[model samples]
Target: MKLMVSFSRKKVSEPIIARAVMDTGVLINVERARIEPTEGDVLIDVPDESARTVCMKMRELGATVSVLRDAIIRDEDECVDCGACISVCPQEAFSFDSDWKLSLDQPRCVLCGRCIQACPHGALSLQK
Candidate 1:
């Protein structure tokens, strides 16, 4: 499961994520992180089995967590595989497979909307 975790500037310096990882035994992969002096937002992936515990722990530490399952949807028919999304994706979520077919690593997506905006064919969209 993927999650978008928000933290206030006051909480940004906390070792909340480390504690959650240690407590829940969940492998947390940070997809994207934007932490400023005033606020922070992080996109992370957690194992399904440990999502509940991790989220609970995050909330207890005063972070806001939102599940991001299937956050980005791609329309194959509309996509020409032009690779527009590839260059702009900070998380490297878009890629070309062995066959040069455009592929998306959904879990790595931060729902940043860059892919959607870069797609000339309007092939990508946020799931809501």
Candidate 2:
């Protein structure tokens, strides 16, 4: 399960994530993060079964948690596979496989909107 964990300045100094992981015994994979001095959020992946446990632990530590499952809504038919997304993707989430087919690695995506704008066919969108 993917989660967006947000923390304020007060909570930033607290080892919230570390505590959550230790308490739940769930290894959290932090995919992306933008933590400023005042506030920030992290995109993380956890075991599906242990996601609830992690979320509860994080919330107990005063962190905001939001689940993002199948966050990317991809339209294969609308995609032309022109490599527009592949060219502009900062995380290298979009790629062309050996068969010359486009592939999307969702875990690497940080929900950046660049790919949606780069796509001429409007094949990709994020679920709110």
Candidate 3:
């Protein structure tokens, strides 16, 4: 099976691509440019047709691929340079660039909500 990554932009753009695999718990897509998925992006689930079907249906519906866990935590532009969430993230999922804007690595982010609970501005979200 093939995993199709759909972007919100026009079809002329390249769709995110991944091979089919089983035991994969979550598929994440990051809007920010700082973070990236290099390896081990695939979960250990057995390869199957059902997983492929789910992915296709979600793409057709324009759902952003993410683990249920990560979607619970929120990431937004209002994140101040508080550095609170960065210290507590078990997955080290949160980071900031030179501009001090928060960047979330969706693949690495498990969406534990430590950051989400800590944010005072309430800017973080797991939605697409």
Span of 10 residues, lowest total lDDT, candidate 3: 38-47
What lDDT does each candidate get? 0.86, 0.85, 0.49
- How do all the candidates rank in terms of TM-score, highest first? 2, 1, 3
lDDT of 2 by residue, 1-128 (tens): 78999999786467777877778888998888888878888988898899888888888888899998667778989987788889788889889999888999887778877998888999999987
TM-score of each: 0.71, 0.74, 0.42
Candidate 1 at 118: error in angstroms? 2.2
TM-score for model 1? 0.71
Clashing pairs in 3: 22-45, 22-46, 22-47, 23-45, 23-46, 24-45, 74-124, 74-125, 75-124, 75-125
Better of 1 and 2 by lDDT: 1
Query: Candidate 1: which stretches are off by over 4 Å?
Result: 10-13, 75-83, 86-105
lDDT of 1 by residue, 29-120 (tens): 88788877788888888888888988898998889999987799998899988898999998898899998899998877777888889899
Q: How many residue pairs clash in all the candidates, one count each?
A: 0, 0, 10
Go through the candidates in order and give the C-alpha RMSD of each one to the true structure.
3.2, 2.9, 12.9
Q: Summing lDDT over every window of 10 consecutive residues in candidate 1, give the lowest-scoring window.
A: 9-18
